[model samples]
Target: GAGVSQSPSNKVTEKGKDVELRCDPISGHTALYWYRQSLGQGLEFLIYFQGNSAPDKSGLPSDRFSAERTGGSVSTLTIQRTQQEDSAVYLCASSLARSGETQYFGPGTRLLVL
Candidate 1:
């Protein structure tokens, strides 16, 4: 009955450091998604997981970004060698069982890289 939730509502990291952001989806949700919203840019799809299917990672900006869903409930987005340009609000969302379903988003995690 709860909405999606993310951890460390805010993060400030130095360049070249690595960070891991966590997401907890609503109970029983089979679809989870991660997105990035930059200062002036629209939501940028990062990745998503649906049931036991393979995750679609085509939206990841580079090899430095990756994510994984464990036990079909929680997920973690890892950014290695973070850069200033990587600063943005990381949003997590979940839907019933598919990508196009109505998504419930979490209060995004604001990440600032110095």
Candidate 2:
């Protein structure tokens, strides 16, 4: 019955540091997705995982960005060598299936790189 949860609702980090953002999806949810949205910008898909299929990381901006889902529930986005451009809201969403389903979002983990 729990909704998605993200930690450190806000993160302030110096440029070039590595940061890990955590996500806890609702129970029994088999599809999860990560998206980044800059101020006033539309959501940019970063990565997604559905059941046992390989994750779709095509939208990951660069090699510095990566994510992993464990036990088919929790996921973490790790940004290596953080940059000022990476300052944005990292949102996590999940649904019962991968297609045609509304994604319920977390409050979001806002990253501010300085």
Candidate 3:
């Protein structure tokens, strides 16, 4: 892809449902990441994957949140049994390197749990 792309820019779901958000990162990038931005909140790191390195999943809020990157390109974030507090923008970013370089962000998947 030319840039980071995320699907279902807006999602509305009832509590306790499951949702899957997708992300397509820029071509040739080696680092991919997922973050959450709640209303009036700062960007919170969720996970990060670098080429052949162990994925960093320390920021996931709970076990209900999970993600994976296949072939170092596309990635998916799955949220299970969602709750009202889960309503927020799920953003995906990618960088050319894994040393905290500047990250390009996707439009984001907006999840609304009511």
Candidate 4:
């Protein structure tokens, strides 16, 4: 991977539908993070994966939202039973360091839960 990027840049789905978002991080980046931006809601951390260590999933809004990073490369965010409130932009970033480093962000996946 060269730059951080997300798939399905825009998506529209009916309520209760399930959507899967994908993110590809930069090569050689050792840390990755996911974030969500919504109307009225600033920025919220969703999760983080550092190297081969266990991912920090505490930021996930609920059980309906889940993610996974494979082989320290690409990562996917799955949102089950999408709702109108779930309409937002999902962003992914990768850094060369675990913390306090420049993290390149993806363009983001715009998901619209109608």
Task: Give the top-scoring candidate (lDDT).
Answer: 1
For model 3, residues 1-114, the per-residue Cα lDDT tens digits are 488999989999999999999999999899999999997667899999998889999999999999988888999999999999999999999999946589999999999999
lDDT of each: 0.94, 0.94, 0.93, 0.92
lDDT score for residue 74 of model 4: 90
**TM-score to native of every candidate shown:** 0.96, 0.95, 0.94, 0.95
Least accurate 10 contiguous residues by lDDT in model 1: 94-103
Candidate 1 backbone collisions, by pair = none
- Runs of candidate 3 with Cα error greater than 4 angstroms are none
User: Per-residue lDDT tens digits of candidate 4, residues 1-114?
Assistant: 469989999999999999999999998898999999998787899999998788999999999999999888999999999989899999999999645999899999999988
As a whole number from 0 to 100, the lDDT of residue 96 in candidate 2 is: 89
RMSD of each: 1.1, 1.2, 1.3, 1.2
Better of 1 and 3 by TM-score: 1
The alpha-carbon root-mean-square deviation between model 4 and the true structure, to one decimal in Å, is: 1.2
Judged by lDDT against the true structure, how good is candidate 2?
Answer: 0.94
What is the alpha-carbon lDDT of model 1 when measured against the actual structure?
A: 0.94
* Tens-digit lDDT track of model 2 for 1-114: 788999879999999999999999988889999999997667899999998899999999999999999989999999999999999999999998846988899999999999
**How displaced is residue 84 in candidate 3, in Å?**
0.5
- TM-score of model 1 relative to the true fold? 0.96
Candidate 1: tens digits of C-alpha lDDT, residues 1-114:
778999989999999999999999999889999999997777899998999999999899999999999999999999999999999999999989853679999999999999
Worst ten-residue run, lDDT, model 4?
A: 94-103
